[model samples]
Target: MADTVSPRPLRRRRMAILVAALAAVTALACWGAYRWAEAEARAALTLNGDLRLGLYASSIRNAVGRYDYLPFLLARDHEVLDLLDAPSDLRRDAVNRRLETANAAAGSAALYVVDRSGLALAASNWADPAQSFIGHTYDFRPYFRQAVETGSGRYFGIGVTTGLPGYFLSHAVRQGETLTGVAVVKIDLEPVQRDWAAGGERVLVTDENGIVFLSSHAEWKYRALRPLPGAVTDRLAQTRQYDRSDLPPLGLHDGPLMENGARLVSLPISGPEASRRAFLMQELALPEFGWTIRFLSDLEPVKAEATGAAILTAMGILLLAAATALGWQRRQTLRLQREARVTLERRVEERTAELLTANRILRDAQEELVQAGKLAALGQMSAALAHEINQPLAAIRTFVASTRLLAERGETAMVRDNLAMIGDLAERMALLSGHLKEFARKGPARVEAVPVARAMDRALALLASRLREEEVQVDRSIPPDARVRGDAVRLEQVFVNLLRNAADAMEGSGDRRLTLTATRNAEGWEIRIRDTGTGIAEAHQFQLFDPFFTTKEVGQGLGLGLSLSYGIVRDFGGTLRAENNPEGGACFVVQLPEAQ
Candidate 1:
């Protein structure tokens, strides 16, 4: 056995060990908190950066695409074609003035016409005394060569005459099969740069070759994002794309890799000292223009926030350790915790009961609303039923008066015919009443093969007196065998509703014409009812088929005719739509599927 150690020395050694362990744990906790906070902050920054990247991409695309149609449209202008077809000073002057006006209106940098040999025939800047593109020859430009070969081309380069940069859009002008010339529109993209500069975020737009053509920072423009190969540099020089020889690198150094393909990068700020800063870099591609957009988010604020979180975490760990050393105090409050738990349980039960009562009340209110809707629908159906019967009643009165006059003259044949017509009218009224009752019950309509011609004839016969009173000219183009799958009585009711609406629409019109046309399609038959009257209001077009929607005066309609017709057509597996005719008036189309 070893010699006995002193208690004071042993206790002191154990205490020292404990203090070392605590210090290590506290440091580790703080580091973990800092890492977590920095990661969370970077994730948020990446999300926001990606959003800004997309918006910047869209702005660039819209700015460039707005001028895309200019070149193609101007290529077909007669003046441009004439100037290309026959070169003359007189025609050239006329075209130059026309182009100048168009350029100003379109807000393009320049508009010019080039003939087959790539000679500028006329330009928008022909009147510019300093330097005009009128006499400039662009046979060597890639846009001119490409347009001649492929009928159209697009390129971005520095203008040789003006020494200014622009995006060039070209379209080939053709005469019969021969290529005549090319129309070119130059668009200035500096406004887009200015817009980006106004925003707080830093943005850079680069082409396929990694050359930054547009940047929020003017100093970054024309700088290569990466090292350029010999071939790329040669091509750039040949095309005169940048109009600069000393193309410096942006010196963007990659840092740590990030989630979602985002990464950390160090960018050099513009100054004599050339200080560098860390950025969370995100990239988005604009495939339409074969360009890439980069968004840079500063990370200094994120670092500061993480540092503060680390300090708070260190303090929390110290407090947690102290609480652990004093954990025996929790035992003293066990009885009080049990009493509080019981009280909480009782309160929860009371709240649950209250919620159940509220739910029952809500259900009862819902039932009441449903019942109120049913009653309203019944009222609308009653109004629609009366409106349907009034028309036949008027016609019956007219026929009955005619029959009495004929009977006095002893024309038994005419009286018999009038009696038969009255009987038919009475049956029709009864049928309509029955159908309306069925509709109120939400029952389906009877389906069968109904002839379109017969339906039109019956509707027209019913409205003959009204048509005569309104002096309406009826035109029919319905085929004899044109039929559809639907309930005949309901179908006839549809036609009557449509015809009455048309006639009413033409009430005060100088020319009252009702055109009924039916034609066969691949799937079924399309029947159109058109009226030469005041057209439907644009504000009410979409709501025509909605229940209780109407434009008629009081007592004239129940606002249920179109709604009922639309439902009837839908029940037959068909569609009914209304539109304002381009010529005048309104047209209602009913499309029904073909009968097997």
Candidate 2:
């Protein structure tokens, strides 16, 4: 049912397609070669510019270092010291001659000394009366104020005396605690600019305020790289950083940018050359002096190579495009397959992350159980607190009854004293309650040095009534000077818990003695609270300090006391241990490092 075409016409069609492809590929190869040559030329230019900048920066650093050295040397001179001690006119000439000789030897533009009043007392150029700095006041200058206040300073300005732009390095001359005067070395910074100009390279140096003070291009000097704030502009005017010159903003259009180590931003140069001007702008930071150095290279010079590249490359692009089309199609297919697999893997990762988050939630729920245990420990302390307050209240009730009898007898002074005594007892009860509330509070998770005797005294004061009521023989052998590093309140709690346990353990014993002993060894501080009772049974001794393990009757204690105490000690880089003493008592020993 199909019409069969001649084989010769099909062969002719295939030959025509092959010939067209060959022609296209040949054109593409020629275009690629031309473009490659142009890229190589631009790369060479970038490398050459970078090398030149490095050399120039190195030379600038070396020159800048010279200005720093001369002032430090001049400040220490004996003649300069003498002039600062006494700004007498009789000493001025000798100081000037010595300065002039030193200035010439050191290659400084000028060397001068200013008094406390900022008046030039002596100078190296005193021989030329026209250019002499003597008797001229520089109080308006930043260098004068900086040197007096900071002991060293640097400033760039135009000289009022010589009318020359230069950098002034200044140091304070001190005479035993008093600031006497300033020693200054003025150095001309123009030679570097001159060298740059001679090489036909444009460079600019700007201060922290972005005001240009040095430049190879004369028109750029005294211009601001950025818009200056009103206050800064006024300050500069007052200090005369640029003398009477009106500083203007550079007004650069921040558009295209390229970089290697240098950020090349295009700056539009105004005037007749503005239309053809395109410059490569880069900056280097002089962090020590809080200044910036800007470099500019004109792109107009490289236009010839670009033009030639375009003209040569235009002849061959279509051919290369035809030759690479098949390979490009195959590459696109492979990329699509890879992307699909990556998308599937990313979905798996997202699901895995969700699982990990669920596991974290489970871990957090487990943590809630531990916090509940801490709250339960607080609940257990409620009984001890009530017992502590009950004793004080009982005492207060007896005092009140006694006071009523004293009032009826008209023993006015005795009644007053009893009332005062009642007040004291009330205050004591308040302090006890406050201490309990604070002890149970979960605030201020911090630790500090805890003095052993002081903390023990606090605990003993709380338990004093209990001990007397229980007829407990208390033998405390703790030295006043012993100290340990821990949370003071927590350490006090440890002692309170130990004391309460001691009193309870010795309840039925005939001889009830709570002996507290504290001693310092080379490693740390050791404290022992020993209660003379029917000592701990052998079976319970091993689990004495474990959580929820207690020898006392249920509801009498939380079993968390020793467990929490052990944890607190461990957290403070210490240890707590319990053992039945050989001398017939249960002893709780706490070892803590001495406070650093």
Best by TM-score: 1
Candidate 1 structure lDDT: 0.80
Clashing pairs in 1: none
lDDT of 2 by residue, 1-596 (tens): 99999999997997789668766765566566545644554455566555555656665666667568767766776777887887676677778876776565456789999988899988989999899998899988999999988999888899978889988889988888888888898887787677666666767788998888877778778888778889998988899877887788875545455646544455556686674356666677877777877777655434444444544343234324433543344466677657645654575566456556544643453343222111111312333355456545766777778799999999999999878877866776776666556655745446677789888886776577678888998898998778888877667767877888889889998999999999888778999999998788888877777644567663455466777677778878888888888989889999999987
Residues 133-161, model 1: lDDT tens digits = 88778878888988999988888777889
Task: List TM-score per model, in order.
Answer: 0.55, 0.47
lDDT scores of the candidates, listed in order = 0.80, 0.72
Runs of candidate 2 with Cα error greater than 4 angstroms are: 1-43, 259-261, 268-276, 301-303, 310-596
* C-alpha positional error of residue 330 in candidate 2 after TM-score superposition, expressed in Å: 34
